[model samples]
Structures are given as structure tokens and as C-alpha cells.
Target: MPGLDYFSFAEMWSPLFLVFMLLIATLYAFVVGPWRQRFGGVEAVPVVRQLAFYGAMLLLYLVHGGPLSLLGHLMFTFHMTDMAISYIIVPPLLLYGIPGWLWKWAFGRAFWKPFRLFANPLFGLFAFNLLFSFYHMPDVHDWVMTHYVIHGFFYALLLVVALLNWWHVMCPVPEWSRVTSLRKLGYIFANGLLLTPACVLIIFAPEPLFAVYNDPQVWVQAMGYCVSGDPARLLEQFEGPAFFNLMSGREDQQLGGIVMKLLQEFVNIWALYSVFMQWYRKEKSQEDDPAFDHAASGRLNNV
Candidate 1:
């Protein structure tokens, strides 16, 4: 890990994204808290919703704007960790954080027809997995990591699709809901299945799959996206990623893939449980209805 410390930026922390996150939280507060009457009918956003939004912003900064971002550039394992948080965790948080009224206002507008189409359960499932799988192709992955703009664009797309996918399940806004209670299980399971092949490809590769992670030259070039403050210093002192505990480059890559798949499984299972419980409760409530009791009694009297 000694050589890997070169990628650490404890000495020179970048606060650009910290500032940006704060600005976003502040703007949201203004729009949702004080200026609500001016902008829309939403005058009082719930405190919990505010907390969710702020939490997501802070997590985003920690992952992308903080030292963890540096680690991601240095190692593929950290990179996949970054992806899990950004796409898997953050999107649902964002969906839950924003008020349903806000979503309704947006969806009620003229352009929501297309939004509804894209955010449909089936479409989100297919589109996100397809884009995600394509992104992992070694050549495509290498090119993306090496170019900062494309890297940002690709990740941004991932986040958008992630949001769309989760919205089908959470559907915080009532109008845009696609999947019914039972169908949610199928939707979530299908997503995990689609995502599994990509992880398996990385996990079972006989050799390292990503050159940006395995090849020192390719790694350094991609590293430039994070370690922007000092190129010459890095040139003189750069060493490849550390594979601790007798792990080789391929082993490290496989570990990353394993971690990605594990996180996905955990999230999907939690979602399935949540959806199933909600469905179960609704069915139980219907059975407990006074109308249902009266109907059963009438049938018994006939007997």
C-alpha cells in the first residue's frame, strides 16, 4: 500500500464539489422552504424530505468530490464502490427525498408523456442494464476513464437511468407508477439478472479485464482525471495500485466484481422484501374490511 499512498490526497483536498453540494442544498432549501409559494404550490416540504436530499448531496460529495474519488481513480475496487453508491443508493434516496408534489408538478406538465415511457418498469430495466453492460466493455471502459468529460457524461447517464429504474418501484409520485405490487418483484429480479452477467464477466475473467486498472500507463492516464493538481510530481513518483495480502491484479479486479454483485444483491433483496410486505398488508387490509366481513356473514346465514 506504500506506493498506493501516492494517489492519496490528504495533503491537498479539493473543495470544488463540497462547495457545489452546499450550493445545491441551499438552493433546494430556498425552493422548498421559503420560496415555495413563489415557485409552486409546495410551501412546506417535510423535514424528512429535506434531510434525504441533503444526505444524498453529502454522500455524493464524499464519493466523487472527496478523497474517496481519488481512491476510485487509483483502484477498480474503489471505483465499483463509487458506482454502487452513486447509482444504486443515491437514486432511490433522491426519489424519496424530493416531495411527491414536486414530482407531480413536473409529471403533470406537457413533456411527461415521454418521461412516463422511459420510466416504465420494463424500459428502465432494459435500458439501464444495457447501458451499464455496454459501459463495462474493456475498450469502452478504458476510453471512458481516460477522458474526464465522457466519464462524467457516462456516469451522469447511469444516474439518470438509475433514478428511472427505481422510480418504477418507489414511484413516490402516484401518477407515474408503472409496476403494480406483485410486478415489483419481477421488475427487481429481472434487473439483478441483467446486471449479473457484467459482474460475472469481470469476476471470472482469467486475466485482468480493465486495462485502465491493470496497465500502469493506462492507469496513469485515467488517474489524471482525479490527481489534477500535480502531473509532474506524479510522473516522478507514480506507482501502480497496491494488491495487498498476496493478491494479484486479476484477483483485485475479481474482488471488485464480487463486491459490486454483493451490493446489488443486498439492495435488490431489501427492495423485494419491502414491496412484498406492502402488498401483503394491502391484501390483509382488504380481507379485514367491514364490507368483506358482512358479505361472509351473509353467505354463512344462507348456509
Candidate 2:
């Protein structure tokens, strides 16, 4: 119910409290559930990993979505970068690193049917991409940037798509659905390819695209009043009010794009390696076993 703003986020009730809730939920899931069962009765992820991950995510929210978000509202480059990474990269990695069962228990039942539909290969991939692309269009992007509810919904939808996309590549339930190692590798690379054009456009575009990028009032509305210069001066250099000249925006947006692409490549390489090793081992085992085909056939039919 609290709004998204610098003081609001810094005030302990907004992002800080939201982060605490996330920690509590994660702790409960790991400690009371999987971690408890897995490690004899004790429950704790390696303290270092959990702490580091949460710390980074918290800092990121503070920097990008908090005070910095205000500055970005004035600057086209910063805003673009903020939207790209906050929506595309950070959430998925954070979610993926989380123990799978915890997420399953949290959103598993209530959102199960929709989650599955979204996770479906055909439905999930294209729909999220379409929506993501459309949301970034100038008018729609400006609208979402201007409205609180729309912004929150856009971020939430992006996270859902991220979850589904990752699930297809790293499935926890093999019985429900699965892709071969080669296929998983292929899927990741394909994702990389699909997201590439947008990154290129953002990085290489000759000038700003959205109205918020050029107008001060719109930029302020989009970013929440965090700019560094006189509103008039900032508007003078550019045709409009976009934090048009800030290196921060250029650095942030470009780096975010690079990070997204690189992160995808890293995960994909790992997945490819894993799949290849698994398949090679499986194939070798079959070669040594005379009854492998019959056993495989039986398993296939059961599925």
C-alpha cells in the first residue's frame, strides 16, 4: 500500500520491510522444509551464499529502484538500464538460486495452473516476449513508467516469465516435463538470440525513444523526482527533459544489457555442459546394458 519512492523505500517500511518478508519466507521454506529434511534436522543454506545473495539484491533495489530511480526518471539512459536489468536479469537469478521447493510451496498451489500454462514452452516464451517487447514500446513504456500500478504489474509479469523460462531449462519435476541436455542448451542460446535485438537497439539507438526520455515532468513522474540539475538546465541541453547527457545512464543501460547477455551465456554454457555429460553417461550405460532399450521403452510408455 506504500508507494514506490526514495524516502518511502529508505524509510524501513517499504523495500526494507519487503526484503525482510522475503527473508522470512525464504528462511521458513528452507529451514522448515527442504533444508530440514535434507540435512538430518538442521536447516540452513551456507550462510555466506544466502547472505551475499540477499545483500546484493537489497543493494541493487536501493540503488536502482530507490533514490537512483529518481535520477533515472530524468535521464533516459539510466531509466532504460534500470528497466532492462531490474525486469530482465536480477529477479530470475535470485529466484533460481533459491531452493526450488520453497518457491513451489509459496506460489505452487494457488498459481499452479497458470504457472504451468506460462511455463509451457510455446505459450510461455512467446507471450512473455511479446508482452515484454510491447511494454517497452514508447507510449506503453511511458505509460507504465508514469503509473504505479502498471509499473508493479509489469515487473511482476516479467518475474513470472523469468520463472517459467528458467523452469523449462532447469526443471525440478522431471515427471511433468523435461528437455534433453542438448535441447536445454539450445533453449538457452535461443533465449539469448531473442533478447539480443532489444539490447542492441537500446545501446545503439541514435536518440531517445520514449517521451519520458525528453520531457521533464514526464521524466519526474516516471522516476520520482531524483534528478541532479535544475529542471530547466537539464531540459535545455536536450530537445526535452531526458537526463539526456548523464554518463550514469549510459553506463547503467549498456552494462545492464551486457550483463543480461553474459549471464544468459554463462547459465547456458553450464546447462549445455551438464546436459552433454548426462547424455554421454546415459548413452554409455545403455551401450553396456543389453536390456537398456526395453527398460527405456517401458519408462517412456509410463510417461
Candidate 3:
């Protein structure tokens, strides 16, 4: 008999993971509030920024530490959903939530010169897409899911690259920004173009592209990453991912590709809109401001 209890809390509740999430939240609260004065008189973050940080952490827990994580191991579709939320959505929240002063302090060190290279609008666009695409290559994918440590390390790298990719556009630290309005627009559009090939390959592949979903042996081993208990018992109880699958593996892979692209598009579209609105408002503000010179001031006021 097939079962999805491997993804069920009844069988595999992750209390340790829950504790870890709570610990992070507590740390964030202290850092942005009572801990600020201790950090060389860094001011408290705005309430809205505080909410973004907390909310991002909460979503991280829900998606990665709770049922969604188990679901990710269960199916490729859910796995892509996990990636979308974690890599695409969470980093922006973090960028926005952290105070600019804190970012200044962090990147002020000489160690970040390497990050500056990757964080450039032109390079970030190419680097993030290149790394992201490489990670999905079937050979690379098999190697990672087979090794939990490598899997964790690879995604951690992706998260870092993701943060760098978004830096030029949403850089909380003003001094760090390297792109102007036109370049920002070009950078985002280029990113969308660069990433499309990965999704297109996944979506159009004639067969399932990932070993973790298509091969029962690899699938079972991958499940071991999430499913707890004895190997012998686990093997006896479950046959493969089919035990938990609701759709054919091919369909699952295709759907996963589509979902990833759509999620990426949604985030990019919002980013473009935010950039446009900010630019519009800035131009409006400039037009309204009276110039310092008398004649210029009079002309601005008349306009």
C-alpha cells in the first residue's frame, strides 16, 4: 500500500526545526529592538520593516520547516514551490527589513569586494541566472539530492547569490547601489530573459529531467532526507515516491517547471512596477522642488 505519511506530521513532526525557527525570530526581535542601542547606537528599525523581517521568518518556517518541506520531498511541484518562496520572495523581505545602517556596517568591511563584483547590475543578472541554471542540470541535481550536506550547501549558495542579484535594485544601503533608473530597468528585464531558458528546458523536456522524481531508488533515498526512522523499516513500509504522488512524474516535473516560471514572473513584474513608481515619484518631487537660485526657484514655482 502507498502512503504519504512521510509527509505527515503524525509520522514526522520536526520539533527541533520548530525550535530553530522560534530561536531565529527571537533573535530578530532583539536585534531590531532592544539590541539596537548596543550595536553602536544603531536606531530601531521602523515598525513596517520589523513586520517584513518577522513575516519573512514566519513564512520561511512554514514553507521550509513545516509541512511544505515534507511536501517538497514528496513531489517536484511542491519542491519548486519551496524554492520559489525561499529564494525569490524571502531575500527581498530580508533586504527591505534590515536597516540601511546595519547594511552599511556589514558591507563596510574590506571583505565584501568580491560581493561587489557579483552584485553589479550587469554581473548579478548573468551570475544568478548562470548559477541557477547550472544547479538544475540533471547530473548536478542527482549529485545534490543524494547528499544532504551538498543539497543544503548548494541552496545556501543560491540564497547568497539571490541576495546579491537583488541588491542593485532594492539595495537598502544607498552607497552600495551601482545602477541608475534606466540600468535597473534593463537589469531586471535581462534577468527575466536569462532565466527563461532553464524553465523552458524543464517544461519542454520529453522525459522527466530529475532523477529524484523519476527513479525509485533515488526517490527513496531523497525521501530519507526528510523521512525519519530506521532504513530497513522505511524501505519495508514504502516503495517509492509513488507512495505519495498524486500526479504522474512527468506531469509533476512539467508542472513544477511552469510553477517556477510563473512565480519568478510574478516577483519580477512586481519589481518592475516598484521601480517605475519610485522613479515617477522622484521625478515629480524634483519638479515640485524650488531650485536654490532665485530665478530658477521662481521658474520652478511657476511650473
For candidate 1, the lDDT comes to: 0.79
**Candidate lDDT (C-alpha), each:** 0.79, 0.58, 0.79
TM-score against truth, every candidate: 0.88, 0.67, 0.89
Q: Given candidate 3, what's the lDDT at residue 73?
A: 71
Error of 3 at 214 (Å): 1.7
lDDT of 3 by residue, 1-303 (tens): 146543457335577777887898898788777777655435668899988988888778767677777777768898889888988889899999988877776678889887656666767677678988998888898789889999889888888888888888798987667776656788888888988998999888898888887787787787777766643355566666666787888889899999999999999999999998887887678677776355774575455
Q: How well is each residue in 245-288 modelled by candidate 1, as lDDT tens digits?
A: 13677887888899888988898999999999998897688678
lDDT of 2 at 8: 35
Name the regions of candidate 2 deviating beyond 4 angstroms: 1-60, 63-77, 80-84, 91-95, 103-115, 225-244, 247-303
The model with the greatest TM-score is: 3
Cα deviation of 30, candidate 3, in Å: 1.2
- Residue 247, candidate 1: alpha-carbon lDDT: 68
lDDT of 2: 0.58
Off by over 4 Å in 1: 1-12, 39-44, 229-232, 243-246, 292-303
Candidate 2 residue lDDT tens string, 1-303: 112231333432346545665775577446645666543443354555465456546545644445545545545544545555564455554654455454555555765785555566756556666666677666888898878787877877876676667676656445545666556667767776777776676666665566676656676565443433443443344443422353444454465456555655665676678667876897788788886786775576466
